[model samples]
Target: MSYLYLTILFPLIGFIILAAGRDRLSENVAAIIGVGAVGLSALTTLYAGLDFYQQGGMAYNQNLWTWFNVGGFAPQIGLHLDGLSLLMTGMVTGVGFLIHIFASWYMRGDEYGYARFFSYFNLFVASMLVLVLGDNLALLFLGWEGVGLCSYLLIGYYYVNPANGWAAIKAFTVTRVGDVFLLIALFLLYQQFGTLDTVYIVENAHVVLTDSNLAFWTALMLFLGAAGKSAQIPLQTWLADAMAGPTPVSALIHAATMVTAGVYLTSRTYTVFEMAPQVLQFISITGAVTLLVAGFAALVQTDIKRVLAYSTMSQLGYMFMAVGAEAYQAGLFHMLTHAFFKALLFLSSGAVIIACHHEQNIFKMGGLWKKIPFVFACFVVGGGALAALPFITVGYFSKDAILGAVYAHGQIANLPLYNCLYWTGVAGAFLTSIYTFRLIWLVFFGQEKTHAHPIKGVTYWGPLSILLVLSTGVGALLKAPVEKLLTSAQIPVFAIPESLEHAVHGAEHTAVGIALGGLVIGVILFAFAYNAVKTIANTGFGAGISHIWRTAFGFDALYNIVFVKPFLLLARLLGRDPVDGLWLLVPALVKGGHKFTSYRQTGLLREYASSIGLGVVVLLIVLIITQVGV
Candidate 1:
């Protein structure tokens, strides 16, 4: 437990080393340092996790120092090791290390900024660790902003391309919208409670926030902040575009790090949400809507990474729905399974992209299943898990847990809204199945369209194979311990009423049928009915809808018209404003005066002497006039 800080320190040190040694370090050395740092962090998390649970999963606060003392609002720089943090730390480091190992293979020949890439990658892991492990809101926000900064850097890693740079900026700018809401939440929490300690805030929220409306507003602000980071609804446009980064960056951001931070935040502060039932309902509705939107968007995406990217948004919506339902354990459980399968899917897609000579459009490559059989198998398991194949995949268990809990919550509360949310989850699962398998079929089947290079080496297959197993039923075993841990912490959860148990079981079974049904339909449609799919996509009403879905229902364009254009127009307007011109006059006059004064200072010796004589005469005239009081 004492060595918990090492988890963050190792990665931080790795970032420093890689950053300092940028051009000096060989590829092997940089890869070793980068992968080894996260490996050490994962080991530390394992050791600390064992010790933590052995001591009965009690909340462990390791206070390192007092950050500041300000009029009784003193928050310590501390680490919090509770069930939630431990789970999150394990996921971030464990999945992150694997991604780093695979990245070494994926990014082998990049002589430009290889070490720099790993530096940003290492810092991303460390920042996420800080976010999950921090004991106070301020320290957590530091980690929060750190994650955001690294995302921007990595997303724009291929900076020679202007489009990638714009993608990075878009991601940074969009998420900051939520960050502001989060910052405001922090100030509100501090004002209301006099401290920003996470443990204290969660434990005492019910006591201090006696006004229901106050609790609702505070939680709403926090959710808004979370919604931004998690890429829900309006803030979601940045994530698909964020696929411009390296595939490993896509895996890291989508699977294990930045997107999950929002879910973690909402889950960590579950008590606050618990106090505001209305806010909780709002969260569920937002999540439900987001999942549907993202799922439909995924359906029309041609870029393989963008397909997975939208799937990530859709999956994150599930987590948000779980948290909003007061099913914290279920949400975290889904997050865990999602980390494995989504990472598998993204990294496998990376292999596909690599083998196809970086071709990203699924239609450009087919029948490569025979060419890269291992990668094909990877897609099968990963995509199957993503689609939640019944009884065989971890996603099935975790996702069902969420839907079951949501169903039970709705029935128990007798809320028609929650029941509708349960149906929304089912509909999302159906969409997930269709697009997931649609990707698999279009890329791996049909006439071979491109030559694929053979994929080999330990780094390539090792992580994928391991993640493959975890994406299966074997990974479902973790759910029990996770449930026990969170329940032990007394985090609020929705319980199914005994009377509604049968109905909940029915709901689960219905979801299973829907998932299977979607899979079968997707295979048939893409495999046998592809011409019809194509005809629909290229023609009338179907084409219009496809275009809308392709554009993520034009949220990007809508935001452009509503927000981006207006802001840019205003900026251009301000560019020539009279007020700005007024301020500009000072610099303009100063520059003019400098030009006038320097015009006579040419380097010719005769000109210099003439100027000096004229100056002397002028000085004598000025002195005579002053003396005569002119």
Candidate 2:
């Protein structure tokens, strides 16, 4: 088989092995199979990347079979390996392997579902690979729903907990809302183009529908699908609650693989988006608003995981902004860097939570820097990358690339919106830095406020060490290749003017300054506020803001009022009158039917026999009469 096939197949093999041997395999063996599958896939992806680089944009399609062939249309089961797929494949497998390894240790003593966890983890990786590598829209949809199913299973792995189950349902239901749009978009595409093949659809979409109006509507509808998958705007709330799952699940799905689906969709359909600049602008605005709203939500969160969850939402918003502005490379580069550090942060926090016996409330615990030095160091490195700390980190390079692209847009004399995007991006960066470090100081550096728990084992430290190295170095290493991949050979239509050169660079510097300043101020403010709150609690005056922040800005309450309450009220009204009245009528209908049927039957057996005999005689006489008449 080709490397492309191997890249997608190994994870399936791993999933099968773990699942079939769930009761027999040792945890160590299962971990190896789980992590090894993704690791091998990652290596295959690297080989594919190198091969693609040498060949200079070759598309590899491996057809397994015809999925469907009917009525002048054919959709096949196949995998497509190209620059875009190669990029996503590498990120998914590489990060997925790390998460699997981390989970091996994280789930060690859980005992109840040890084998099951690896099975789900491997399957999740396989589904994600299928998503990235699928050659046609139908295959892609299969991967789409596959990942959604895996997400629900993994999110509610602790199924005994009602809250985790509910969280899983919420995630599945919310994403389904988006998936509906995606399915509709796909059907519409097939209807218009008569083909589900990526290349064919992209190449012939314009010809299939010559009207610009139709093209715009089609593109806009597809983007709605992307928005839901990418967690942009109104659909974004579920990502925060998704932290109810294990930390590694949070890192893998939220940080690396699943949430980036929308980005991939948009990138793959660049031709479609290019046709609809209005849709593109709408995407940018939605991204900007999500960034701001999620950032505020992050600022108020207390649980360590919830903080990271909101951070993921905010960062995803920045990525969407990059896509909206047509800075595909910048968006993807940030995606790459964000994957490394965010995974590291989440994994490191997992170690902390494990060490603290599952205490996620940062206010209850502090001074962990000394207890878990390696984890603390990893957190700092990850946090520094997240805060875009100067020259040394991956986040700096990628984030600066995005800001630079947005600034370049501002140089277009006629486009005032680019300037707005630039400013919005800058503000996003500053807020990101502030909330990120606030998490850092509150969790790792303050006075120890909770009881101490000792942590054990070499497994915990191993995965974290690997991630730390990547988070620090991958940015500079991938910079040139990423820049080339994103930008076309031809010069861009937009240009940054010399007059605005100072302003652009100055804005970047200002953003950096704000980032650092936010970090410093956040640390000081958290320390002071935490200390004062503790003192006030000792004096009984600390309940107000604490209660508000813990309630998550009342978004849940609003949802309850607007969605839950109204639906429940409607159900109640229907149950009381309309449904009950129908049930009452059902009994009368049953009685009337029974009474009508009684007239056809006789009480005595002889009478029933006579009725049957007379009916037979009448039928025969009628048959004879009809034959004579004919």
Best by lDDT: 1
Residue-pair clashes per candidate, as listed? Answer: 0, 0
Q: Which lDDT tens digits does candidate 1 get at residues 1-630?
A: 887899999999999999999999999999999999999999999999889888988888888899888887777879999888988999999999999999999999885588999999999999999999999999999999999999999999999999999999999999999999999999989989988988889989889988898888999999999999999987888899899999999999999999999999999998888889999999999999999999999999989999999999998999999988888888889999999999999999999999999999998999988999989998998898888888899999999889999898887777888899999999999999999999999899989998998989899999998999999999999978888777766766567778888999999999989989999899889988989888887888898999999998899889999998999989988887879678998999999999998886778999888888999999999999999996
Q: What local lDDT does model 1 show for residue 440? A: 93
TM-score of each predicted structure versus truth: 0.92, 0.87
Model 2, residue 537: C-alpha shift (Å): 12
Between which residue pairs do clashes occur in model 1?
A: none
lDDT (C-alpha, whole model) for all candidates:
0.92, 0.79
Q: Candidate 2's residue-wise lDDT over 1-630, tens digit each?
A: 265788878989988988899879887888888888888988888888877778776667788888877897777878887666777888898888778878888988675567788888888888888888898888888888888888898888888889999999988988898899888888888878878888777766556767678777888878888777778877776788788888888988876788988888887777777777888888888888887777777776778998888778878888878777877777887888889889999998898888888999987878888887888899889988887888878888878767776766656545778778777877777777778877878777868876556666666777777778878855568777655554432212234578777877787787788778877777666766767646664553455644544454566778789998999999878776876687899899999999988976768899889888999999999999999999
After superposition, the stretches of candidate 1 with alpha carbons farther than 4 Å from their true spots are 583-630
